[model samples]
Target chain A: MAKVPVQFTLNGSEKAEFIESGTTLLHALRDKIGDTSPKGGCHQGTCGACSVIIDGELRLSCLTLAETCSGADIKTTAGLAEGGVLHPLQRAFLDAFATQCGFCTPGMIMAAKVLLDRTPNPSREDVVEALSGNICRCTGYEPIVQAVLTAARANSQNAA
Target chain B: MELRRDYFADVRKDGLHEIGQPRPRLDSPGHVTGKTAYFADRNFPGMLHLKMVRSPHHHARIRSIDTSEAEKHPGVVRVLTAKDVPHNVYTILILIQIGPEDETVLADGKVRWKGEAVVAVLAETERAAQEAAAKVKVDYEVLPAVFDMEEALKPGAPLVNEYHGQNYYLYDSGECRKVRFGDVEAGFAKADHILEQSYQSSPIEHAPTETTGCVVAPEGNDRFTCYTNTQAMFFTLDNTSIILQMPGNKLHFVGGTVGGGFGGKVDVIVEPIAILGAKLTGRPVSFIYSREEEMQISSPRAAEKVVIKDGVMKDGRIVARKVTGYTDAGAYSRHSPYGAQKGAGHYPGPYTVPNVWIDTYCVYTNRTPSSAMRGFGVTIGDFALEVQMDKLARLIGMDPLEFRFINAYRDGDMKAHRQPTEGAALIECMQEASRAANWPVAEKYMAMSSYRKGA
Candidate 1:
């Protein structure tokens, strides 16, 4: 089998690697690049467990080909904390007890960050729409919605 | 299965930290940070991928299996047929009744189900193993199949297991569990009005975000480690040990971060397949069910048909209640015997029927095996009884809430079967729910509006 060389910035670190032509971005980040924090859950992109920020846009890594991710800047769940301090959304998810089971939290948090970065102050419906793709079985989406609203309050206070 | 109440009395006083409070799961951080490794994430050097070649026919006599073409494929490691499997009848999910073991991990001389595994393929790549699986050919003599429970119960129907006697799994005419208390016939005779109706509950999928997946490998000499996603991890470990014919200590079970169970993940599904694949390849193997496989092969919630006969006195008190329910325990009796017992335990609406009789029939079907879901069997029973209660109340010219409260089993009251209602809060929950939902306004709107009984 012929190996294809791919280069990308993962969690702000540059790396070049060789992966199979059919390798998914999820397999490359997890198996090849030794970044196991993004998770592997339904490979079909239905369960958003493999979500990562690619070129500053939230995307399902399982659905994206390794070749497509070449020369792209990607951010994973491991980059959510700044120098050991938890992100506002992460803290809110923890404090509000919205992180039950937690399989979808990384994707949900990344999805929320995209919404929060753009909106800064999102309504309930906006928050729902932002995290709609991410499916959480335990929390029933109530606490997750509340967590986003709480994080929005904290973010606005920090901005002021 | 033996029916017994497993409720912990005075459990609240045991510890303040045990229940009611939001105790954060210890594994939350790992899962949230994507640090929790699942079965599908596990990988080893020189590991092989395993895939099964399933039978398309629901019931068939296997004439021949030609794996020569598949074995010659590039990257293919090995192809295991029924001749390789030691156990002719592989049963991980055994029926609770202790008779009629009705399943196979890999089909032997006969294939009873459509998705029954016949041949297993191990290859250098998952894609290769998958591609090679499609090449394995099996000649089968197709037989008559039965898919409906009622049809399966009828005499002269196609037998799922011909040795199990007359298409029925267990004797006693489909009614696995029955309960009788008081003079139900005499009570019905004395009643002013009698109501008979049948209600059907639909089958629902668990739809767990994480599909079933497992990775099996040799831990060391005479030992193996299997990582799987399951609801009852310890139970699955015990079942896997029995199926593999290995000692408990020789098999190690590592649980993956559970996506969701809702009671559906309690069965043995993918772990055994992975273990079988590992044994064949002598290399670490992982088998993850695709979404389609998860839906078609994996167990779903059992559907039920309930028939209720209610008797009410002129004074708005329930005189007697008779209920007969048929549970569609698809393919195999996974949890049906116990589910039948629970479904017929009590009619479980907040009413005091002086006389009662309940019987549950768990019939077999050709669909995916039915297993536990949320609320076990009580959820389906409660809906049927509650709706019938509402209809009965309307017949007696009384408000449904008032009728329910009049006969509702209180904490100290004896139930229809003369059993004390331990820790009952039926009235309180109903009142609170009514207050919370603004029931008075809703009721007034329904009464004032042109919403007749049929409309």
Candidate 2:
């Protein structure tokens, strides 16, 4: 197997690197780039555990090959906090207890963030519709929905 | 969401939330942040990948195995057959009758079902390991397989387990668990009407976002480190120890942040295979099942056919209940006996009855084995009994909710299985739900157009 040189922006920093052809983007992020934000839950795309923002779009890192991310700007859940303060969504998630087992949280939160960013103030039904794809076995999807609605409400109130 | 002064006072006085309050889960952060390290993501130095060679025939006598090509492959480090297995049998799920002494770690001399592991191959690369596994060949003397329970029980049908001398997996004497209270016949005689119905549930997958996978690394002398997505970590460690002929202290089992179990991942699916592969290579070996493999091979909800009978009076009081459950045990009676037993015990559906009888048959099937899932065999049974009650209520020209309210088990109602239900909250839940949804009105909405959509 030949080591292929691939260059990509990770989180915020620019990077130029080479990886094996078979190296999944998840492996590249965790091993090469040292970003552990994209967890490998299901190697397949079934579990959104290995989700990353590629070119401002949420994508499963496990399914994406390293070669595909050569020119793409990547964002991870670890990049959510700008400085010392928690992102409002992350804070609301913590306050609302929207997480359990925590494995699926990153993907779910990223997915939620995408939805919230697209529509700052979403309804309860909209929240459910947003996070439906990300499966949370614990809490039966109730708390997560509540947390999203809470985040949306907070965002709207802050705007006001 | 608020309640009485006493209830609301706890929030101010003790600074505590409601006990049943809808709080979000606690583990979502680690999961959402990608900080959670599920077992398959772990990396180690000199790590090798493992793959298995499985049987194609459901029932077969292993004639011979050819692994020369696979062993000679460029990246392949080791190829193992049953001859290499130190332990003959290892149980994955230990319940009544079938304990840690029953299941096979590797197919030894005979393969009982299709997809049973026959050989394991280890290579430096996962792709290489998979490629090399295809090189290994096994010859088998095919035997007629039995896919039906009734056929297996017959005198001359092909025996899946001839060594056991009977088709019965767990209980040779029949009843997994039996409970007797009042005379059911006498209790039924006092009732105004008797209702009997059979309900069947299809097999369902847990479909846990994560598929079964395990990474096993040799720690020291006969000791191994295992990281897998298993619900019952202790059970996996114990069973793996027994199968490897190693001490319990020699094995360490770590559960990854499982995506979702719903009880399916409780059974050890990828552990033994990974362990066997690691043993062959003497290197860190990781084995991950494909989604298709996970779906077909891993434990599923037991497909059940339950027959429930209830004797109710004119006033909607249930006097007697009898339930019979037939659960498809699949390839092995892993947790079927216990699951079926629990199903039988819970079937009367939280109702008050003087007499009850539940019979559960853990019948055999050639498909993947059935094990635990959410509700632990209670949910399906509950659905069956509740639907029956609704149908019976409609037949008697009474409102379903009213009928349920009339016969609802309360603080002092004796359960069908003879236990007194103390602190029964069904009525309270019903009242709250009805107040929220408006019961009679909700029923009216069910009759509304299917095209209508709203929250």
Candidate 3:
């Protein structure tokens, strides 16, 4: 099979690469582009560990082919922080001690980022509903839920 | 998550710093940023991907295996069988003198359970390895398999494990792990009423977010560096070294941050094979279980069947308790033997029953070999014991909490294992739980303490 060429804006930077026809965006990012943020949890979109924000929508990278993601803008958990400054969600997750084992943190943060970007002042139930796709087996969902609420409050206070 | 005002008033007489303080995990930033170096995160130059050719039949004799088609695949490097393993026979518990080396790194002659690896194919890519693995054919003579614990133990049942020479692994005394304290029959003769009930639980998976995996890099002078997510690092190093027949120092294990082991990753499953693949190919090799494989093949919590018989007095005192149970260890003993022993040790619960007897059988079945999970042996036993306690309380028309308060173990009590109980806090814990739940206790029960009685 011939490698197909792909170009996309990744983490606010333009990048170009050649990928196989059936290569997933996750493989293209980790294997080809050398970005290891998005992890492969269940390669079957059931586990949201491969979540990436593409064109202002949260999509599972494992389900999205690299060819389909061509010319799209992608954002991963690695790109959330700017100039060494932590994103409010990242800061709040740390402050609330929401992460354990940390394998689910990247995808969880990515999913939470999309939620906060769209609904800044999401209620506890809203956070729970938004993060239903992401699974963190260690924390039992309480600390992560609390962290998202804390981040939402912090973001609202900053805006005020 | 607010702490109750009197939550630790009785337990926190001694000041503590790290015990109840809010401390952020050291790895949270790395986790959030996706910069943490898990075993799968690292990629090496000229690294080969390994995929196992597993058995489709639960119980079968391998008539023959044909690896020609797999070897002829374009990117396939090498295919290894049990013959390639230097020391093929192993059980994780062998380090503690608890096994007869029942399992092989790869299936040897026969596969006792479904999904047992028979061949390992190394290739340039994971897809190529998986494709090649599917091509390796095996002719199997399927045999009748027994899956139930009790059925496997009956006379003329299909043998599940040949290493043990029986369906059950015997303790040093040549029987099931036994816990005999006092004359239970005599205690029962003096009782007013008796209750008997059976409890059963299916096997449970740990289902950690990150599945079991390992990456082995061969280095100079026969040294191999392993990056894994195992909870027990030294156990992996020691067991993998034993399996590889190499010096313990030759394998340098670099791991501590498990994605969520919960006792699952303690089994030395992938490291030895990954190391062997690296050694045979003279290149780095990575072997990771897919989520399906992890769920299907990885060792799960042993399913348990417990029968609890209690002799109780009208005053809510348990005169005698006998717990006879079976822990389905599946086809091999990984940790189930020890887990069964632990279950027997936790018998009669945390109470002061005058007489107690426990017999826990580590029974084998033609299922995925069960091993450790969170609280492996004791958790299931506690499930049955506590439920029995609740039922016993209800039968005698006593409040469950008050019944427990009356029978809770105190310090200086003797356990069923002939060991004196020390620092027992069941009374205090029940009191705290009742207080938290606002379950009103009588003034007499409230004064109950775990401190040494009659001191």
Q: TM-scores, in order shown?
A: 0.90, 0.85, 0.97
Question: Residue pairs in steric clash, candidate 1?
Answer: none
Q: Between candidates 1 and 2, which one is better according to TM-score?
A: 1
Q: Please state every model's RMSD to the true fold in angstroms.
A: 6.3, 6.3, 1.7
Candidate 1: how large is its RMSD? 6.3
Model 1 segments more than 4 A misplaced: B1-23, B88-97, B166-174, B348-350, B411-418, B440-455
Q: How close is candidate 2 to the true structure, as a TM-score?
A: 0.85
- lDDT (Cα, tens digit) per residue for candidate 1, span B15-128: 434445566667766655666676666777778888889889888999998999999899998887766654435444452334455666677778877887788888988889
Q: List the residue pairs that clash in candidate 3.
A: none
Regions more than 4 Å wrong, model 3: B1-13, B452-455
Chain A only: give the TM-score of model 1: 0.95
What is the alpha-carbon lDDT of model 2 when measured against the actual structure?
Answer: 0.74
Ranking by lDDT: 3, 1, 2
lDDT of 3 by residue, B1-455 (tens): 34444533655566555666788788888988888888888788899999999999899999999999999998999999999999999988778887789988899889999999899999999999999999999999999999999999999999988888899998895669888888999989998889999999999988888889998899888899999999889878888888989999889888887778888888888999999999999999999899999899999999999999999998989999999989999998999999999988888889988799889999999999999898888999999999999999999999999988878888788888878888787876777788789998887877777873542
Interface Cα root-mean-square deviation for all models: 2.0, 3.1, 1.0
> Could you give candidate 3's per-residue lDDT for residues A1-160 as a string of tens digits?
6989999999999999988899999999987888888988789988788899999999999999999988899999989899999999999889988888888888889889999999999988899998999988785589899999999999999999
